[model samples]
Target chain A: MAEKVIAGRTIQVNDEGYMTNPSEWTREIAAEMAKEEGITLTDKHYAVLEYIREKALAGETLTIRKIGSSGIVDLKEFYQLFPGGPLKLASKLAGIPKPTSCV
Target chain B: MATKEEYPLKKVLIICAKGNLEDVYAALVMANGAVMEGIETKLFFTFFGLDAITKKRMNCLHTATVGNPALRMPGGLPFPTLLGILPGVEAGVSAMMRKEMDKLDIPPVKEFLEMITAGGGEIYACKLAADMFKLKKEDFTEEVLDIITVGQFYEMAGGIGTQIIFV
Candidate 1:
């Protein structure tokens, strides 16, 4: 584990940079991480991120299929929202643990 | 101390030569998973594996109840090969398998292919197998980009950090 200072607040993160405590996340922190991933978080991106964080916190297994049916963005749009490894990147940007799903 | 270097796979060429439900799903899941990971993936179906892309048979794939020793009853009992010979047993087992996979949010063959293509993964069918089975281009689902020979497939498979998998 590592302590990362993001958006001027220190947060606990795992080795791969996923926040250990998602409750520490903020829009500013997400914006900083999104910039690291070369993404510009729009309202559309935030909608999907928020939806995913909610499902992930409730212990729902996150998959591309589940995200496609999320009604906010379809699978293709989700991929475009966070290009490479969408679910993984989204989880990290959403301040959740790295996703372990393979689907 | 010497440290191991990492060379992640950049491309995957997956070949599915069997038509069984498990075989086709395995290929699809791998291809989909790879594409989702930002790896370039090409799926090639050959021999009976064409059933996975064939429009009429794609969604109705059957598990080999008779020969799959790993098959089991719902309660984890060994599924007898003799019982597999009963009429409709294979269909029932295949349906059960689909249901279980659905519970895991796994999609049917059609949607799986769609998901792969939507993510820019290309799907192909073996030319020889298609010719032998009298399958035309139109016989396959639209997800199949083309019917190609092994030579063409290998040509595309050539690259650093590329691996070819046969299922």
Candidate 2:
């Protein structure tokens, strides 16, 4: 486990850089992480992030194409927003565990 | 700000070295999964993997049943190696595999590639393989990004947070 200081708030993160405790996540933390990923947080990105958090809170397992089919964003836009790895990166930014099916 | 190299596990590069139905699908599933995970994903096709993107063979790909230890009949019966060598057996097995994939609503090879590329995945073919097979650039589907040498391939794979997977 590793600790990250975002907005003067300390949060626990896994070795993969995912927040280990969802309760410690905040909009400030998300913004900080997004900046680190070279993205400027926009409403579109927030919509996807919040969608992930909502589904994670409800105990759902999400895959890349699942989000593509969600109609929040098309597959192409999803990739554009989260270029490297959409589901894993989004979940990490959203303070959720990496989706098990991603690997 | 952290440099790109400092980032751990940034992108995924999947190498599809086999052209068989199962092998190509395995690579596709993983690459597509990576993209959905918001990971940057690139797939490199080498040797027989070229069949996956070849316009003529992509749709006609077949499952390899011969000497495949993990293959089983529809009823969970073990697939006998001897039975796999018989005429039409491989095609039957391939048809069965396609049917199962259809039941799961999996897309066909071409469509799957389209979906992956549209989702921001990159696709490339091996230059050596293409030359050996006498394939020209126009011989492949529109989704292929380029035909590159091994050296170029490694260079592309070299990046922070990038993981190279062989399937």
Candidate 3:
């Protein structure tokens, strides 16, 4: 048994830590997830989220540590902005054809 | 079994020092390759490289002449330096290069920068070069993220897997 819902979606996390349906994920999905997590999704949040997703889709596989090193924004602020946090947000929004472990 | 690391060259920093045809072409090739490989690419233009981004000089970049072996004339004819001085020679070469790039689906320098930035890559202008060249912020393409020092560029390039390349 694995966690089905992190923020809002009924996502299935495998034992290997991959999202079952990563292709269906999008920035809007992440935004909605953030909302369900009790966080407001602002344009700036979307910008950062989208940027991260683009990089991930490009196959960057950004970790929280790597995200922190980017210097695009503060890590603490990033945490507060995204509901599922960097790793989840990056995985959900990365636009990868399939979901793999982002942890 | 060992799993190979995927998405090599995740972070690329392209230092553009010349805006001529070969230089700009080199930068574009590298940047495009990085983008295709899903890497985060950044292009920092300095000195002559700034010309590639400037509105006035971008379309007017010249071809390199000195020390280029392919520039020799045929039939044992000595290549005339005056031909380079002729009007539209540089423009013609630039046009041809642009056509070839377009055929290859490589975006223009400005649009390429936009695509890179839009795709999660950062673009920066060299502050020292900008100041030395007396270039205002408005003089550069709007895709420029900021005017940063070389140290700042290093800071961006500093990471476990980041790569810094000069093209």
Q: Using TM-score as the measure, which candidate wins?
A: 1
lDDT string, candidate 3, A10-102, tens digits = 665555444555565656666665565566677777666666766776766454434544666554455545432345544544433232332
Using DockQ as the measure, the top candidate is 1
The TM-score, computed over Cα atoms with residue i paired to residue i, of candidate 1 is: 0.97
- Model 3, B43-162: lDDT tens digits are 889989999888777766667544444654535565466675668765665676678666645556766665555445567789999999999889988878889998998888876668
Task: Return whichever of 1 and 3 wins on DockQ.
Answer: 1
- Where model 2 places Cα greater than 4 Å from the true spot, the runs are A1-38, A57-59, B1-15, B29-42, B82-89, B95-108, B115-121, B131-134, B149-167
User: What's the lDDT for residue B151 in model 1?
Assistant: 93
TM-score of candidate 2 on Cα atoms, chains taken together = 0.68
**Clashes in model 3: which pairs?**
A58-B38
**lDDT (CA) per prediction:** 0.93, 0.85, 0.65
Report DockQ per prediction, comma-separated.
0.81, 0.33, 0.04
Better of 2 and 3 by DockQ: 2
* Model 1 lDDT per residue over A1-100, tens place: 9998988999999999999998999999999999988888999999998999999999998999998888999888887888978889999999998888
When superposed on Cα atoms, how far off is each prediction in RMSD? 1.3, 5.5, 10.4
The model with the greater TM-score, 2 or 3, is: 2
In model 1, residue pairs whose N, Cα or C atoms come closer than 3 Å (at least 3 residues apart or on different chains), thus clashing, are none
For B61-150, candidate 1 gives per-residue lDDT tens digits of 999989788999989999999999999999999998999999999999999999999888999999999999999999999999999998
Worst 10 residues of 1 chain B by lDDT: B65-74
